[model samples]
Each structure stands twice: as C-alpha cells, then as structure tokens.
Target: MTTLIRYRDDAPQQALESSTDGAVIIERLAALGVGFERWSTSRSPLPAAASADAILAAYAAEIARLREQGGYTTADVVRLTPDHPEREALRGKFIEEHTHSEDEVRFFVEGGGAFYLHIGDSVYQLLCERGDLLRVPANARHWFDMGPRPRFTAIRLFTDPAGWVGHFTGDGLSARFPRYGEPYAGA
Candidate 1:
C-alpha cells in the first residue's frame, strides 16, 4: 500500500499526519503543488525485469499522454535489485538532498520506493508502490530512498534531454530522517 507521512522539518521525530488513503494522499500532495496519482498497471504485459525499450513500449500511451501534458521529451526505465554491483553507491547518491532543473516524475512499475520532500517547514515522506505515479515539481528539495536491499522498477519521464542531473543541496537534513527500511511507521 502507498503511504504518506508528513513531519515537521525541524522535528522529524514525530509525524504530523500520515495516511494510506489514496484520495487523502492526492489531496495533501496536490495542495503542495506536487502531483500524485494511481495508474492502472493491468495493460502492461511486460514483466518487472523487462528491458527499458520493452517497458517503455508497454506504457507508450501513458507516456505519450504525460509527455503531451508536461512537455516531457524522453522516458526510460530504471531497475535495481539487491545484487546490483553498485547498490550502496547508488543508494548513497540518491539519499542525499538534491534538486533537478526540471520536474522529477516517476511511475512505479514494480516494488516500491520512498521520496522525502523538504518543503517549507514540513517534510513529506511518500512511499510509492506499484501503479503509483509521483511528480515532484522542479527545484523541489528532496531525496529518494530505495531501501537498503533495494528492488524496484520504475518509469521516469524527463523534460530535459540530458535526463537526471542532481544539484546537491549540502543540507545534510536527510541524515536526520529514517531511511527506507528503517522504523518510520510510528513517525
């Protein structure tokens, strides 16, 4: 199930709000200018381990619609398993707070991942499972955690042809928050 947890940026020890309801999550994120939705994953015949081209082809219609809506020019698939050779390094890179030149959008095709968005005085931690689509607006201060033993496949949409290029914020705020596999449910 998808989960959304909101915490005060200055006090990550407690959650101000947490919900697993889709409508509530959508409303909360939408109010903050973030786009959230649940897409139907039934049409894709491709498996989670399918090649990027195959995955992209399976979701061409949805991708095309998103491209038309967000002016996105390219789309791709990123898959990572626990045995990935650079799992630690990749996880480390993603756990650092950063911003992109264009909006960061992703649709989880398999497994799940967490995104922590630092906006104003709140930190919204969103767990995106299969069929969940999240779009963090451009320049949003955030970091992603795919868990210590990562396993997921996601479709990413990009407006910039250059693709994902993170501009590190060097805030070290992420270090204070619980990571993907940690005990954050109580918060």
Candidate 2:
C-alpha cells in the first residue's frame, strides 16, 4: 500500500494528514507537480529470473522505455536495509537541499520511505511503500528519509545517469519537511 503524510517541519511526531489510499496520494502529489503511481503485482520485475546478460538486457530495455515515457536519462537501482551502514551515511550526506537536472524516479519493492518535495513554498511528503513509485521533476528541490531499520528495497529509475547527479542547494528548505522512520500501518 502507498501512504502520504503531512506534518509541519518542526512537528514530525504527528502527521496533519495521512492516507493509504492511492487516489488521495496521487492527487496530493500531483498537486505539487510530482508524479506517482501504483504498479500491478503482475508487472513486477524479477532480476533473478534472468541470466546476468539477460538481466542487463532487460534493465537496458526498461530504462529505454522509462526514458521514452517519462523523459528521463538514467536510473539507479538499490536494495536498502536498516542494517546498511551506508544508510546513515547517505542520509547524512543528503541533509542539504538539492535538485537534479531530470526527475527523481523511485519505486519501492520491499520497504517504504518519505520523499519530501519542496515545490514553491509548499512541501509534499510522500510515503512510498512497496509497489509504490514516484517521479519528481527536474529542478525540484527535495530530500528523502528512511526508517531506522528499513527492511526495504527499491528500484530507482532516472532520466540521466549523469544529469541525475545532485547539485547541492545551500538553502535549508529541506528543513521544511519531515524526517521519516517507523512503520506506517502498524507502528
């Protein structure tokens, strides 16, 4: 299920609005100029089903398709775990605001996280669970925060591998959004 939660920048303890409804999530995100969707279980991609060469081939094909459909140039796929030491490091590294030349595409396959997009003065914070995806456009400043122990994996589709590169934004706009942790449904 996909989730969306809104909170004042300083009040992460309680969400002003939270929902697991896909329609609501999409509508809210769309309002901020962010694109989001849910994929059917039938369309799930399994890397293990193919040989190494075949996997690469499939990945290439998928990349091309996404590029054509979403105007993206490159992509990154990652499997995240709460135990990953780099998780904290990556979080620390991204504390500053930033933007990409192309949209930021991410599909959660295992775990969930909050992607906060700072569009104009409003902040759109999306909680992306498994099977949920989000595409934030070029020059959209934002930041992401995952749980303390993410049992999650995600596929990140991008428009430009290089253009997707981050340009550090000196502003503290990121401080306007929430920091994420904990389960959305049970905890």
Instruction: Give the top-scoring candidate (TM-score).
Output: 1
RMSD, one per candidate, in order: 1.5, 4.0
Instruction: Give the worst 10-residue stretch by lDDT in candidate 1.
Output: 178-187
Question: In model 1, where do residues sit more than 4 Å from their true spots?
Answer: 185-187
Residue pairs in candidate 1 whose N, alpha carbon or C atoms collide under 3 angstroms: none
Off by over 4 Å in 2: 7-15, 42-65, 173-177, 182-187
Cα lDDT tens digits, model 2, 1-187, are 4667666555444556677788888888888788788865443455533343442343465557667998765555677666787877766665567888877887665567777766654455676776776887888888877755655566677655765577888877565444565432211
Superposed by TM-score, candidate 1 places the C-alpha of residue 32 at a distance from the truth, in angstroms, of: 0.7
TM-score of 2: 0.75
Relative to the true structure, candidate 1 reaches a TM of 0.94
Cα-lDDT of candidate 2:
0.66
